[model samples]
Target: MTNNQRTEAVYIHIPFCTNKCFYCDFNSYVLKDQPVMDYLRALDHEMELTVKAHPPGAIKSIFVGGGTPTVLKPDEMEYFLHSVKRHFPVWSDDIEFSMEANPGTTDLEKLKVMREGGVNRISFGVQAFQNSLLSGIGRIHDTDDVYRSLDNARAAGFDNMSIDLMFGLPNQTLEMLAESVDKALELRLPHYSIYSLKVEENTLFHTMYQKNQLPLPDEEDELNMYLLLMERMKAAGYKQYEISNFAKPGYESRHNMTYWRNEDYYGLGAGAHGYINRQRHVNIKGVNPYNEAARTGLPRLESFEVSREEAMEDFLMVGLRVLDGISRTRFEQQFDASLDEVFKRPLSKMVSAGLLETTEDGYRLSSKGILFGNEVFAEFIGTLSAN
Candidate 1:
């Protein structure tokens, strides 16, 4: 069995945005006429109840995500950050405090507020570097906003920064993606997360797709886009640490590593999901409902315990996403069982099929496996029984 230890990571959510993007299905509402302060107070209460129940360790990482966290007014941001420190008082000396921002939202004063509040890293949602693509995707900001925001972030004393880019966008071509990549690399940020667009349910993209209005790249074109990005990022000296994420050495996202490693973290605020002591819980999704629910207790929409078999499967599904792959010693430490013994069947089959290669530490996806990652991950799900 895994040893008992307090969680060392925290994730806070801010569910307000200036406007919802066409492709985004995240739990966020437009910022007009919303009870911003009331929501912050509710989040503060949630943090209080959480720490009292589980008692956090010296927090090694804190990531404040949102529809657009930088959209918060400076006063509201200050209040929220102060509350975070008050509840989880102890922090590691080198704690990674990250906040997600969007172009056109993070002005110099707002960013300085964030830095003063202990946010040391910023991830901007600069989906593409083209003005037409930005407008087509329902983004309010253009390429100019991207450059100006990066400049402001730097002026506000932020050097450790990252930006997101998208591939397989509607009406996007191989040439378009290449141009976006060139502009992104020009910024020379420490980290980059480039993802292929997925048409998830309840988003405008899904509606358009069903009506045959969305003109997304074809499958072959999408595959080429992924391959092109991998080669370019490698040539530019960025390591493809995960399938879609590339970073300079030691600049990987530590907060995300907690989830990939299947560790516990405190998830607070509306629409946030938290896993602690083997139990997972998702807070209420709606803003007013969440505010009301946190008044008395934990605002959990649903809570459940993760079974050992499921946890083991998850260990493979997420751990293998890292380029270095899961560690054998780490697996043994968590499950008190040998990695080879527990997953002998799937391990042997995958190795035989040439999708997974054995490492000195454990198992990782081969080059071919990276292209067909979904099939490899699907192999492990529901394959284990609760013995």
Candidate 2:
């Protein structure tokens, strides 16, 4: 019933931060001696120009994620949020507005500002509970700061909050992972996103990893961490809707579901990707280029088309990540080709290998395949009908 072309979700990327984390390679910069207000102005310009191309119909969810959205001063944040509200048309209902915050930077006053500015959900980057691990990961906020930040968020009347916790850090043990889970359960938020540490390119962690300075957990231990998290999350009455995300019923992230379900969404800000009107495009990464593009009333699109064959592959790949999988009726409607006709080989192989299973409504990844998803997905790659 939802209109994917006239998307109901939008993502705005804030690319400024106070400090970069050791493992972060996102397009965020240290806000030192930079024209912060000017960047906001450029972002505002981008929003206005970009929405003109798409039908800004009733947005159900808006997620402002970035280098650290809370790093903006109260007035700066006010301007930014207001800019978003002004440009994006919304449906007449309670909209889910979620923003990512860094713990050390967000305080009582700033959180209150966000709440008043129509932010209903807040996801804090409280990566770990131990101060030692926090420092090892190059996070400025310690355990105390995280506690204080959560308290501040609560006081600001933000109930639907989520905290991010990570496992598999350098030298992280099973005990430490348990402690993090226990600490998370104590706060008792409606949702939790638990991720394993990944050494990304151009990050300090990657350099340290190459030099053998970052002693990550062995493969078996890492697998143990995943197993432990799954068991604990289920025990805590949270559903493992996605590989790294757990949520209490009805508190699942609507914004993220837009991505995993392969629905259409508008991705604004530098280096953002969007899929609209059966075409996919990525915005320019350079701040200056994006600004100039916006000024010229043109989108800074690097690529413009996504093949129909590729779209079907994307549907399978992303839909398999969800617990409910894709709707067969919807697939038939979109492609005008039966799901079986389109992916007969891959589906048969997956089901035969016990990696995917056909349900009454559609197909879903099997439990074993959920644990080893990559191998299962790879079987579908080569055989896709080329557009």
Candidate that would win on lDDT: 1
Per-residue accuracy of model 2 over 1-387 as CA lDDT, tens digit each? 134446788998888888989999998888877567777788888787677767677889999888888999999999988898888846448788999998888888889889988899999999888889999999999888888989999999999999999999997999999999999999999999999888999999999988989989999999899899899999999998887889999999999998887778888887778777666778877666666676666546676776678778888888788876667887877677788888888899889989888898789888888888878767766566542
Writing each residue's lDDT as its tens digit, candidate 1 over 162-253 gives 99999999999999999999989998999999999999999999999999999999999999999999999999999999988999999999
How many clashes (backbone atoms < 3 Å, residues ≥3 apart in a chain or on different chains) does model 2 have? Answer: 1
Off-target runs (Cα >4 Å) in candidate 1 are 1-3, 385-387
Using all chains and alpha carbons, the TM-scores for the candidates as numbered come to 0.98, 0.95
Clashing pairs in 1: none
In model 2, residue pairs whose N, Cα or C atoms come closer than 3 Å (at least 3 residues apart or on different chains), thus clashing, are: 58-91
User: What would you estimate as the lDDT of candidate 1?
Assistant: 0.93
The alpha-carbon deviation from the true structure for residue 256 of candidate 1, after best TM-score superposition, in angstroms, is: 0.7
* Candidate 1: Cα lDDT at 152: 96
Candidate 1: TM-score?
0.98
